[model samples]
Target: MVRGDPIDRRLRTLVLLGLLLGLAGCAGGAHRLPYDSWRLGLFAPNYMEVWIETADAVDVQDRVFRRAMNGVAAINTPKNLKGDPRGWPTRSGAGAGKQVLGADLPRLVYVRWQSLAEPQTYEAYIVIPEATRRAMVKPETGYCPARGIWREDYRDMLTVGLAPGGIARVWLMGGCLSAIDVVRVQGTVVKKGPYGGKSGGQHRPLSATSKAYIEKYGIPYGSW
Candidate 1:
């Protein structure tokens, strides 16, 4: 059997060890990162009812549309928004109002909604800011490694707020219902004038919580 010099053998062993260490570092880095799929919640905070025609997640890398939501419509009715005593929009426990959106960060979200009262349809292809995506996967504030990680408490849910005049806002619902505004995407009207039935009813007054929200963060286009 042929054998290399002792120094040559040691150098080859070191190179192989270096490669293994590099691969291990990469694997560890990826393991610490969060997954691509996350839960999503939709809300209609406007007094007038809003019908969601489509809410899709677009993988811009592949240019494919993923139907993240199906058979669900958001309307700001008293009963629909009743679960949360704080008056913030909550899931109605019916239909797929809350679903999983699978896509990488900074993906495009295309939403289409119909203002039932105005009978106008609005649509927009919104993009989530890259910074916001990074924040979403960050470790919890005051985290302690000794306590271990609670995978479920990773704050992996995002809420989309819909209002009249095609004003759309995205919020990251952190632990303990702490919502942080991520981005605002303005939509353009696609169709106008009574596309279907008449107005559901007269516009109701904004809920107290909604009033506070608007006072802090005004709705787009001066829409209620």
Candidate 2:
């Protein structure tokens, strides 16, 4: 029990670390990370995160950012209708932004998107346990059976499961940035606004219009 004993010092360090973890685990009450905002707003336990970028470039226009979106969006669109949707750099702005699923998700896979300064937009579908998915997709929430061109809003969440596990995809309207971070789902959102306006139940139905849009433009990447 000596104050400066090796065992005593080790115990003290462990206690300090535990306290720091507790501070970080504000929501779930469990020791966890995501202490910084760079994580993808998934500050909880038992979650998995995957990340892919726009393949970085000297010229933002040269980046395969839209193709990255098209690569995944191809799952639903018609085979013949070619090309990933294009973007307008003047419209969406050149700043960074973050978005979140306001409600705890009920689906096995939840979508997260982040805009970056590396001339990239980050998006990922973090898969959860089936049981958790089932519990989260409440009747009122209408999270399963993902739908058409509508996206990044609460109402479209009903249509989020459009392609089984691949439903949660992100679309960027376009712009360019200078510097940024990886933004994994485990981070929290500090600065928030209408990264894209909330859908507020005003969603586009899975109509021919939407199908045509997807076929011609990919999954609602830029504007119509």
Least well predicted 10-residue stretch by lDDT in candidate 2: 55-64
As a TM-score, model 2 comes out at 0.18
lDDT of each: 0.51, 0.23
**What is the lDDT, from 0 to 100, of the residue 154 in candidate 2?**
22
Model 1 TM-score, 2 decimals: 0.56
- Total backbone clashes of candidate 2, pairs 3 or more residues apart or in separate chains: 15
Return the clash pairs for model 1, or none: none
> What is candidate 2's lDDT per residue for 1-224, written digit by digit as tens?
10111223313333343334332122233212122111112110001111222111001011111211111111222334443333212222212223221222211122333321111223333322223223222222222223433222221111111121212321221111111111122322213311233533222233353355444444442231
Q: For model 2, what is the error of residue 108's alpha carbon versus the real structure, in angstroms, after optimal superposition?
A: 16
Error of model 1, residue 86, in angstroms: 15
Q: Encode model 1's per-residue lDDT on 1-224: one tens digit a residue.
A: 11112223313333343334332222212323375466566766544446676666533232333346633355443534333222335432222254444444334566776655343677766666555666667756533244664434445566677667777777775443346667787888764322222444333234465455445544444642
